[model samples]
Target: MIVAHWPPISATLCPKFSGHVNKPLKGLRSFTFNSSFSFKASFRCYCIKNENPNKISSEEGFSVLGSDIPWDSGSIWSTMAFYFFSLHIPFSFGGLSVVAQILHQPVIDPQTEALSILTLQTLELIGALLLLNYTAKPGYRFSVFRDVIINLGMSKRPQDRHAVGWSSPTAVNNPILKEILLSSNVSEIACILVYCIVTPLLEETVYRGFLLTSLASTMKWQQAVIITSAIFSAAHFSGENSLQLFIIGCVLGCSYCWTGSLSSSIVIHSLYNALTLTITLLS
Candidate 1:
């Protein structure tokens, strides 16, 4: 059972406990209990508070994963559309272009260009996050990001197990990550930041965190994953990387599903992006 709430961008994954109290469940980071949640049960246990270490240990990992996502599929589509345009339109034909024209900016190396691109992307990320919460909850911000960070257990932790799971069943490359290795376009420190940090965080938040879980509420998590991945690939376009993007989307979907933790998908996404950049830079 996977539950969705807040942006853990509250895009952070929120979890709930099973009917059985004796068994501890995999938990997400702490979130405030409000009417927005589908489950009426209290999740105060997910948070680490001023309580004794004994209590924290007792409540640390109870899961909120299950059915009952509050987001509508229609809203998810609308949000994705808005988010997509925000990413593409500005760079293609808008204020940034006019600014560059007026400034008569000199030709920049790949590194500098990467930095400029990152700046725009950073702004988009901030705006996207705020909009996601504002539109979803009307003046409400969810504790999703903090929750994700908290549950993103260390890789070597003993509790680690298969990521991407059973109830769940679950891009794009103008250039596949494979081709990127030989591109030798590491450019600005911004490029690394964009790919390794920003992209992983942003995209995973939208696709895996928000979209996939929302869809899962209406159908089998597996079917939801497939549909989400198809849309994810299409968003990137039917370029050479279309298949790659689809496959990548599946992997990410699985990671999130199996673990019931956005943190896992995020960590995996970020690391894979980092690896691609590293190999490309080295090559």
Candidate 2:
């Protein structure tokens, strides 16, 4: 009789744990989301502070590969810009694909993308200042830029992940997210004026609109917001100020969550981005 060896099938691939719902962060013990997350339950915990070396051991935080946005069934524009855009490194590279004939360039060049991003960023900043003058509360002046920096996370203190996490959820709740989508408060004239003429449409579409929507599919709403915001900040790596932008990313991500509208997120984002651009341009 001959003995035959067989492969092992592990049942551990899917875990069953207490307090487990079919929600995101399935097995992760640290993340706890009840029906409503109030201001008290949320607190920043630094493993280093507790002297727990085992903490932060999970590699679940950051994503370098790609997010879980559904590329197959989305609009043609989204499929083209977000998914296929990465395949084209050089202009010539995108042109090499068979689909290039029908899709023209087949992908957006990074060079052009970078330039357009900067242009829109600049435009948004100028527009924000103009809009601010008209819309800001009494006694509010551009001079308040200093106060914004101080009150916000732009201070000299070290980066706090807790602050980032708390601030990051704001993307969902912002006012501007509402203004563009469901609000008849502003006229269609105002909507088109901001969405098209004054604001940088492509920037918001790519960063908050497209990317956030994409990531939310794969990640828990919280994780998706954080990851998208990080990418948003890191994509502007040329400024030699990644930390600042990453922190800003947290704020934007949080705003998106608080509002649940990309429009609101974009409005907040446009204001913040424009402010940063102005400061950088002036400096």
Candidate 3:
């Protein structure tokens, strides 16, 4: 039986098949059953698994392409794993914020309240960095800062290039953002410093580093990027402004794809967040 399918396998599956992988059919273009030869050729080698003479070798196999792509079928399990186990930034930050609110006044003073917010944010940021470094494989360990900048200048989009780099740019250009960026004051400056120092490192790792990469493994780059960006945006829902939080999530997601450097994205993210926080504090 010979199975002929267009693009026998998806481009994303290329990486898994390229090397000696534990997964079956790891790196072959397609599967074909030749009863006469009764042999299987994969990678650069040929293997002969004994076959029954009575078996119909002409049994047709389905194509692994089109909407039925294997990567898109059930790869979401990996994404969920990373969301909870590796990239816990969203969960951590949300938990901290809730804790802050619940413990406010009763267990903490005004000064302590501010300090706790800062502390929680700081811990979340650290966890994001550590998660990216430790959880992701080295082959995929991209720098959010460097990679994102490079991507911006590149002529090709990830979808066009047949590569699932990261999530799309969820940040929309808003006039208010410009105004926010332009304003500056002392308290705003302090907030900006904290934001600039914290967000990029933390957010990028959580959204792009862990979430994007994990989703990309099972889903197409486009689908993975969209899903991850949604989750990233959702994490900020507890904040007062849902619209702005989603915008920030998109921007951070795109920044990661464009730069590929977790650190660089952190820098840019930190700067943006700091500016916003500063403006909020000063206003």
Candidate 4:
């Protein structure tokens, strides 16, 4: 207590203590501020670089095969009209000619009927291919068709014979059809090929692939399927069997819509025709 250098303890000591306490807090504040700024900058960069994962790409929206027809284009109607006339007019004329030729014959044999069926089916198949190639770019692929067939096989149900009118004796009693079924020669083989393969392929490609797709461009899918089915049934010109044909057509249309492949409907139709032919042969 000798008053040894009691030189202003309040000023010097208080200033030194306050400086020591303030230094670490200032460094901590600077570090926190720099870290926050850097975090904000990186966050902005990440936001700028990333895309929304939920967005649908254009390719995905329009990648449905057989649906590549330019529905919105003005030329679509003209193209449809061309397809209709080119396909049906030639087929109708050729079919009538064949019927006329057959009727004119002194004898309408099974071989003759088979030949006529083969000719008609061949013409139809050719016309279908032409129309498909002309109207739709990147036309139906075999892979797509195969997928459709597989799907049809997986989804098929056993149909009721009576309900579908197949139980009616008259259904399989057509003289021409009976002759083809009864024959065991090459004519019968040809008949089977036409009914089970060529006919189904042509009809399904036209009605389901081309017509249904065209109709769907303007109408609801349900309406398109119904209208196309109705037209398909009407094209057969079946009398009392028209109702059965209509039901079959509806089934085919639904199959096409479900699978988005003409081949599916074709396979179902072929199997149905094959079953009918088999039953007729047995009976």
Candidate 5:
């Protein structure tokens, strides 16, 4: 009886493997292995990135057209959490409100209102973008849009485009928000910045853009929409405002899911806020 010993397969043997790997399935890398014995055999090995057979597509949230939101569900959650604590600690009312009270400027805060509230919105947006850029994959940073103008322009119809990701998985809206400071000394400019510009951009980006879009990649998109819209509503937090905000959130969420971009929602949000503020001021 002859017991033949075989050397461990090395990388060099891969070249001689006769199996042909066709264009691999999405999220799959194919490897070929060969064995020489009584009969030659070729084996194909596939390393799958999205291994789940039940993973849903983003576009399927409303239709089969597909999702434009990039990043996996895991990345979505991690980034959302990171974005929240990083911004919330510095910018939210609870945060700066404490500093204002301590500084004895609670009643007359001209400088703080201007510096920390009015101007700070721009800084916060810049910081959020920078953070997103840092965490995004190699080629795509804020690659969520078909066109950059779409975030600020008119709505575009949904298409058959899909998102690419390092792995597969799924936001509700952000909880951090901007609001009109009730202090008598708070500037109208600060209110404008918070409502017209800051609130719409920050909230919409967090809620409709990232949160809602991320959830679009799931099987239960309707639930995701309702949940995210509810979160957006809760951030405003008032017995009177809750129902109104919830309705608005539903509209924004549906607009995003249908139009496949943030522009329409942002426009609507900005307009509604501006109108409400204007009416409040006039009255």
Candidate 6:
């Protein structure tokens, strides 16, 4: 016959063993003591620091990819609207006028036309810079241009190579482009400065620095890059070279994302335009 034992009320209230108390029942010993031990062990395990210092915690990883803005902030939408109205619409009108004049003119005055376009671009650039100063966070004034060049080399895949070869413009094939490229003296110098420096700086500031950063506050970085690139390409208003411009926009967007610096994108864009202009002149 089994003997029945009832634990004292004190034993039930405080399961911890004391030298003065009798040993607990065999069933209660394993259930109460082992459970407490297991819980203590688990708590200790969690308290210990991770062995790998390089490994990011789950929370940190999520924070890195997540939006930087508060849910209540409407700055993103306001900035987007400002960019569309202040920059995109005005530039689209100017670009359309240029295209129309180029098509209609029997004999183009490359110098006069280039100077007029440069004047318009300068005004637009000034407006964009002012808007950026007001709406966006302060941007880095300097970046490692060589690092961006290295990244461009490292990131190039077969598809990118194909796109570059396929979309590269030839002055011989496009008469209007050829006329612009073959300009002489002051006109050529002005065109070069506009393409290589002014245009790249303005475009990178507006699209990558302002628009992309604003969008990233509300969406994933990848989505921001895609949307910014699409808008940038569309803003160029180049019918034949639209695909080429889009591909270039994607490249610039990715560079901006990786470097987190508008200067890097500006450098890459300036270099690209200079190289293409060189090729056009040589051919």
Model 5 Cα lDDT, one tens digit per residue, 85-159: 676335543444544566765442443544455444555565555655566565666563333324642211110
Q: Which 10 consecutive residues of model 2 have the lowest summed lDDT?
A: 155-164
lDDT order, best first, reads 4, 6, 5, 1, 3, 2
The whole-model C-alpha lDDT of candidate 1 against the native structure comes to 0.54
My TM-score estimates for the predictions, one after another, are 0.58, 0.33, 0.45, 0.59, 0.58, 0.58
Which of candidates 4 and 5 reaches a greater lDDT? Answer: 4
Model 3 scores a TM of 0.45
Model 3 lDDT per residue over 90-117, tens place: 4343443455456653233333333343
For model 6, residues 50-125, the per-residue Cα lDDT tens digits are 4997887653353232355222246656765786677655642444355446668533366655565566566666
Error (Å) of candidate 6 at residue 196 is: 0.6
Which residue pairs in candidate 5 collide? 59-66, 59-67, 73-170
- Residue-by-residue lDDT tens digits, candidate 1, 1-283: 3444532221222254342233324564545553543543333344344656555332223323465553545687787778767753453224344445555753333343444456655665566566556555422246543443354321110000011110100121213222323334564355566666666666676777778878876667778789988887766544655677788889988878877877777777677766655654454
For model 4, residues 1-283, the per-residue Cα lDDT tens digits are: 1212112112222343443221121222222222222221111111134687998775344324343453334455575567556755455334535464548853445666566656665765665565455544344445434433443221111111221111222266454466655765878887677767776776676677667777766666677778877876665544677788778878888777767777678787888888877777766
Which parts of model 2 have CA positions greater than 4 angstroms off?
Answer: 1-200, 277-283
Better of 2 and 4 by TM-score: 4
By summed lDDT, the worst window of 10 consecutive residues in model 3 runs over 154-163
* Candidate 4 wrong stretches, greater than 4 Å: 1-104, 137-170
Clashing residue pairs in candidate 6 are: none
- Give the 10-residue window scoring lowest on summed lDDT in candidate 4: 155-164
Which candidate do you rate higher for TM-score, 2 or 5? 5
